[model samples]
Target: MNYAKEARDLDFAYKVRHALNESAENLPVATLDRLASARAIALSRKKQEAPAVALAFRGILAGNTGLSFQGPTSWLGKFGVVLPLLVLVMGLFGIYEYEQQQRINDLAEIDVAVLADELPPDAYLDTGFSAFLNKEEE
Candidate 1:
């Protein structure tokens, strides 16, 4: 019995088992199995373990830490509040602009009346060449 090879195989199996257990504690069993197989293959190919182990640890911590305990009033809930406020602000601004346009149109009509009164009496006379030609032809 070659003890060295047996020990190496046992160590590899242990690491794979550890990874699988961590994943299962966090995610579903199928995800755990997939992660375990990938890690085992990577280890068999002599790839690095630091990044993979760190990620697995983070996943386990996130799962066990209960970070999602803040019910509906989390980040998403604030948006529910802010969105309606934004819509109301936009509606008010739209109404203000419409009223402003109506006021400007009314003021324009007043300006037209003032201009008519300010012009001289001769300004209304048709003194252009077309008018002269029309009078001559008539």
Candidate 2:
């Protein structure tokens, strides 16, 4: 009564049955019958141990349920996952907006020569600091 040998034989039979069933369309009738018998034996053994397996899965689910958030600890607790993400997103947006504003301001203060190279001379002809000051006086 070699337990290891018996286990090996059972495992081999299970593998053969699983393979045969997977390729049932191509399998011979005799081989299908043997595979079916092997599968039945394996299923019966599994059925006998089903309760223990079910209990094990139940224990796992119970443990996981406890680990999941019970409820908000306080009003702010609801923001635990959201608060950090919101802060990160807002910070990025703020930085982008600040950089854009800075670029616009820098472009506004660019030298006339640099502006002339980028824009037509006629566009800036009547737009100068003195004109701006005259407008302020008005």
Candidate 3:
């Protein structure tokens, strides 16, 4: 359905009602004449515009009489819908793996530092050592 056409018609009706309400009292002859002239001018312009716009639409419809979307178009539309979802899942998995690798690398680095420092194995169990490791990380 053409929603814009319906909305434009409704808007014109609303404006007409509002104008009628505002002009409920009798107006002066000059004001009425000026309004009549303005209405005639506007109606003439609308008549000129309506035919051209209508014929333009008719011409477009006539030209594209055979154009249609089906078969491959339907397949492509489905692929378009699924491709983004597949890409999103793969991207998330890749990010997850990257973060996991980074965490592993961090732990390995901490292990290597402790080995290099030749700390006693007892130091690993000490609560203070945990704080020392965190401070070093900072």
Off by over 4 Å in 1: 1-72, 117-138
Query: Which segments of candidate 2 are over 4 A away from where they belong?
Result: 1-78, 111-138
Relative to the true structure, how large is the alpha-carbon lDDT of every model?
Answer: 0.74, 0.73, 0.78
Task: Supply the global lDDT for candidate 1.
Answer: 0.74
lDDT of 2 by residue, 1-138 (tens): 699999999999999999976888897899889989999998887744444433344323334334344334433445776789999999999999999999988877776455658556565565685587588999
TM-score per prediction, in order, is 0.33, 0.30, 0.46
In model 2, how large is the Cα lDDT of residue 36?
A: 92
How big is the positional error of residue 105 in model 2, measured in Å on the Cα after superposition?
Answer: 0.3
* Clashing pairs in model 2, backbone N/Cα/C closer than 3 A: none
* Per-model root-mean-square deviation over C-alphas: 18.3, 15.9, 12.7
Residue 136 lDDT in candidate 1: 88
Question: Model 3, 1-138: lDDT tens per residue?
Answer: 599999999999999999997885568888888988999998887744443433343323344333343222455545877889999999999999999999999999988887888677689999998999899999
Give each model's clash number: 0, 0, 0
Answer with 2 or 3, whichever has the higher TM-score: 3
Q: Which 10-residue window of candidate 1 scores lowest in summed lDDT? A: 57-66
